[model samples]
Target: MDRVPQVEFNPMAGLRPAGASFTVFAELREQYDWFRSTVGQGFWVLTRYERILEALNDPERFSSSAITVLDPEPAYRWIPEMLDPPEHTAWRRLLRPHFTPASAAAMEERIREHCRELVDGLAGKGGCDFVADFATRFPTVVFLEMMGLPTERLATFLEWEDTILHRPYEPGRATGRRKALAAVVGCFRELIADRRAEPRDDLVSAALAWRMDGEPVAEDDLLSLCLLLFLAGLDTVTAQLAYMFWHLAGHPADRDRLASDPAAVPTAVEEFLRAHAITVTGRKVTRDGEFHGCPMKAGDMVLLPLNSATRDPAAFPEPERVDLGRHPNRHLAFGAGPHRCLGAHLARLELRIAVEEWHRRIPAYEPDPDRPALEHAAQVLGLDTLPLRWPA
Candidate 1:
């Protein structure tokens, strides 16, 4: 464990055209197995499929304490996502029942109905900003219903989402981010209070009964978990939907296949997820050791861009192209090992339903050439604007 190569890489660079992030990662994957990024306190980038997988699977060696490279030494934690091993296990156990395939299945028809309504409303518009009109709203409605939040506050939630996650982490946005975090924390505090005063048949009420180590979950822990759910629930699916539509809008053959043969949407969803894996998370090295031919030390941040694994030629044949029929597609899009996404089942169902419903209604569409879809690369890769056009 000695000298390490350094690269002037910034994962949180400003917005770029669609697929630019992937292209950058692809070049990095080709050249470097792992390199120390000279961005935000300096972190190692594990660029290969096997290296990233090894780090993700070995949570003991690679802690989830600070799941983002920018904030490797975060002042706070976000419940299950930032927790590791026993603590994370308990939280996952308590929350698993709510996000199981059965739970997602139970809400299938309702999800489909809502997705259809959103699609149908815009079917006649000839063109639309899919990110604003459908992508964000569809998941926000479902998440609000699940958490028992008021639908009337959808606009406010979107505003907070943008400020908290979508913005660049420059000094200019520092105050706005702090204020947004406080607002979210304040909102969750009120929700936790209400749920305690009177329980309801919702996820918030269910959290009141969660126990860790045979004792009631602490108030601070509940707030942390709620904060995690708030960001994760409202944010990830919206990004997934935008990326999926971005792909479908650009690739008509895949879109027509899903539209004509509805049964193909499921596998297509998996492929789209694999190709457009949207999260680029990080892990803090817990102890000093060498890994994947790279020198390591305790407290080092290792970046795990999920797309790097999903798009690795070593893992998937012809990784660049989207093959809807690809099988044994064990991509780390939802992540791997203990920290795998808790909402995976629900997300898959929602994406499947949204694809099915949208293509069924508006079978032919493409990205609006005048207004390109903008993508931001950070902890979570996201689409800012997706202008789509189709014949009325």
Candidate 2:
């Protein structure tokens, strides 16, 4: 009888990849019927593609509130996302209007203007760190503008968000993290006060006037909502842009094809998103349930590898290849069902514009071999520094 090779389960292994598409996730999914991990006596992992889809869709059985990864305290909590059922529905209704396609389209001119300015600034430089100069700044500026925040305070906002999401587990990082989070909370408090004093068309102002169950959205709820939007909108979108650019630069053929025909960007963006799903989501099972025929007990936390699902052979044919013209690409990058990303349309728009404009101006871009490629250090995945060389 043939024996299977001994393999150790290492969660940190997922984080060690210098580039996108870590294979360990797919390997674990294929080998283990259901991967399990124990942290402090009661943590579990659910890695199969099918199990993940079931958990993500069945929010009733797997409540997000039970699994508190960020800001677990009640005093400083967010609305909608953390809430389930009737309450979640109420908050979502108030928030949906701000993210409509027509509303996102209204901001296109502004988003394009920002993209042009960012690219133009790097046009003459022989090379630039794409993350710091372009990817990070682009989405940060757009999100701030959308919230009607002052551009001058962009750095402050970035610091606050990074501390909150990126350093959730490090005790040594707590001091600076707390200070930054305080600054964010303070900033939003003032913004809310001002918006309440004088309402405007911006999201923050719109949220200020929004009411639920015949009562105005409480101050804490408003701040949490704003903070969540800032973090969610900026982090994932920024990481995605960095990963897409990294892939395009490495795969020159795809970049060249995209450059020649800008119209290919929308389709290409979908494929890039599908191919590079680097984040994983967690859910706590409310009741005993069967996942891929494995019994899942109540209170079990399931880690759904979105990256694995996008590459599932059953879902996408030739799952490894990047087909620019991949049609009917239904990826879970933005997630699915009720928890689907509210910012999907806007994120797509931002990516399409970034790819189209960058390719048009730079035309021929490549990674600088001399510089060290930067890796991301958040629950979200992306490059911290992407050094690229192109003609001035």
Candidate 3:
């Protein structure tokens, strides 16, 4: 029998071409069932839908005590995600309601309003950098509003988010990220204090009042949760927005179909997510074992690109095509298993708003001819400059 092929994979290589990084995985997925890649600290690569889903499901063997692939020192110990079952379940119990479907539904109008304002900001202009003008605005602003944040100092959050996720590898970026992390936790502390004194209807206040194991949640625990929410919540949706907008701008057929039928917007959102799933997460192998013919040892890294699974041909017919009507879309864009994204309900609402509102106003937009969509990748990958022009 022939051995499976392995290629040295670099996560940074994905930054150059828009959505090119996942294509590398897709090629490997088609050529071989799995491959070995020098991703992050290096680990066996799983590109197939079943394999990636298997790892995410069997967290016992692939314990996610820490994310080894990105950042030698991760910005913060994100709750629930970085934890295993049982312990993870406890934290999730307290945090779920804040991001529940009901909660996200309640915030839909506010989110829609924010998206309209964002579109309005770029309306008269011939073109706008989707990343700068719109992509960054929706997630950060909505997050700020949802948490009862001032929304004026959104620049601070953006800076922190960029520092932590975009390029922590650059000199001084790691240090900046650590400082930014401290600042984020400090702000969360202040919010907790205020909520303790006079509880509001916001997430912070709700968290403060909540009891874990018949006692109030600990200070550090609350801070970790807040830090995670800020980092993960603001950034992932922002990146996805950039990719989705860039794709729809380029492909008029899908864009028109979605615009023509508002009801199809939700289904189109899933296809967009599947086609451009941005992140590639990691897991630490718990015990020495041969995983589906790949050699893995305890403490070894297992690079699980959610992008890989979502694009696997076995999972979706013609995985590359952005089929708006791809019903029963079981993509892992929001991840799977115990660590599935808590903000999924919020993200769906946000994505739906972005698609519906943007298409409503700028119905005939396309990628700017002069400047191409320049992309970047890390734990979260996306376009920073997606210039789009419409009929003026």
| Model 1: CA > 4 A from native | 1-3, 171-173
Q: lDDT tens digits, residues 12-83, model 1?
A: 887998789999999999988889998878899987788888888999999999887878777778998999
Query: How far is 12's C-alpha from truth in model 1 (Å)?
Result: 0.6
Pairs in steric clash, model 1: none
Against the reference, the lDDT scores of all candidates come to: 0.88, 0.75, 0.81
Q: Between prediction 2 and prediction 3, which has the larger TM-score?
A: 3
Candidate 3 achieves a global lDDT of 0.81
lDDT of 3 by residue, 64-120 (tens): 786646444454577767889888988888888788899889988888888898888
- Over 173-218, each residue of candidate 2 has an lDDT whose tens digit, in order, gives 4678678767877888999889889988789988877777888878
Candidate 2 has a TM-score of: 0.91
**List of clashing residue pairs for candidate 3:** none
Return the TM-score for candidate 1, rounded to 2 decimals. 0.97
- Root-mean-square deviation per candidate: 1.4, 3.3, 2.3
TM-score, model 3 to reference: 0.94
Report the backbone clash tally of model 2.
0
